[model samples]
Target: MSTQSERIKERRKELGLTQQQVADPVGVSRVSITQWENDPSVRISGANLARLAKVLKVSTNYILNGGPSRMEEPSGQYHLENNLAAAPAMHGQVPVISWVQAGAFTEVCHVELDPEDTIWLPRPPGASEDCFALRVVGDSMVPRYNPGTLIFVDPEVQPENGDDVVARLTDSSIEEATFKRLILEPGAPKTLMAINPNWPHRFIEINGNCEIIGTVIADMNLRRR
Candidate 1:
């Protein structure tokens, strides 16, 4: 079994990329890449690890644990056999922002929020480049998403019926975005539902006033631990 540093160096060499080439995309100095490849004790941040995996054209799991390598076609499509050990597909980091920021989230607007103070988490599997994270704020999504849970939202993905989503009511006084499960019925109006049965206001009719900002792809409740 090869060490993590060995795997990184081996893969980079196979791809004919210099340390600086990998460093440029991962947003690090060439010295950092050299340390990552040469020093086993040097730990890489989750964000950098994910970015390195992408720059190397491999999965994070493959870097952490030796596995069947991923192949990228000339067309840039990534494929691995289904029977192989399942690995979490990650591209980069997603910044954790407030519900208010999430409501106003966009490729353009978020850039102004400044990247330095942002708390970035590892991007979830199958998430798009536009993915962002929001902390669960209320009890409306309880039993599944408790307050303070981190929910990754992806605007690029279309919300299907019964998908958990973050939405904003443009016509209403509600300013911050709300997290709810989207319900679409045939011929009837759509609804945003709360999972908690005891909650008094359990559903809100979409009625065209609600604009779904994004679908919840994954969530993490640190309190559960």
Candidate 2:
């Protein structure tokens, strides 16, 4: 049986991809990929391994265990088909911005918030081309959106009551953006709510000092096992 390192090197060579090509998509340097391929015991993070598996078009189980090559003609085609069927229908890439960056992002009216830091994600059905993404910060929306969740926001969508949204406080000095449920009623005050019940001060009334940035259309949780 081949070692895990050998499997990674062999599969990469079979796919005609350079170490840098494999590294770029997984957010690592070429040297890191070289280390991973040269040292069997060097541990690769689960998140990076998953990204690498997706880019290499192989299973994580096969990558880690060095099982029978899925590249064998019969199994290769089947594996390729399965990958295609299971893959996300990627419409385009979206920038994954931080809370501080998100505030700056709202100030600039552009489709690409930060082109250099973006991820390819499936576009929501009927979503316009102006959608962007934000990485959840804090435990405010716990069950619905844990920290590190990637949420796709559509500025074109008209936000309704009870819709999840990204909002910015009107004060330009405040750099952090807020992610919460938007509550709008006919006569009551508009408010933002934290979905997590245990969080102290779970609600903030939206007065004239806030602006709705966008409505969250879809989300992708990247937590690794």
Per-residue lDDT of candidate 2, residues 1-225 (tens digit): 888899899888877788866766565678888998999998764445656776676766678786653422333322233233222323423455567766655565443222223455555676655666777878989988888888998878999999999889885576788888998889989999899999888988978888888899998877571
Model 2 steric clash pairs:
none
Candidate 1 lDDT (Cα, whole model)?
0.75
| Model 2, global lDDT | 0.71
How do the residues 1-225 of candidate 1 rate in per-residue lDDT, one tens digit apiece?
988899999988877777766776565677888898889888775456666776677776788787886545255433333463322233556777777776666423232233235566777877876678888877988898788988899888999999999998888775678899999989978999999988888989878788888999998877452
Candidate 1: residue 145 Cα off by (Å): 1.1
Q: Rate the local accuracy (lDDT) of all candidates.
A: 0.75, 0.71
Superposed on all Cα atoms, the candidates' RMSDs to the truth, in angstroms, are 14.0, 13.7
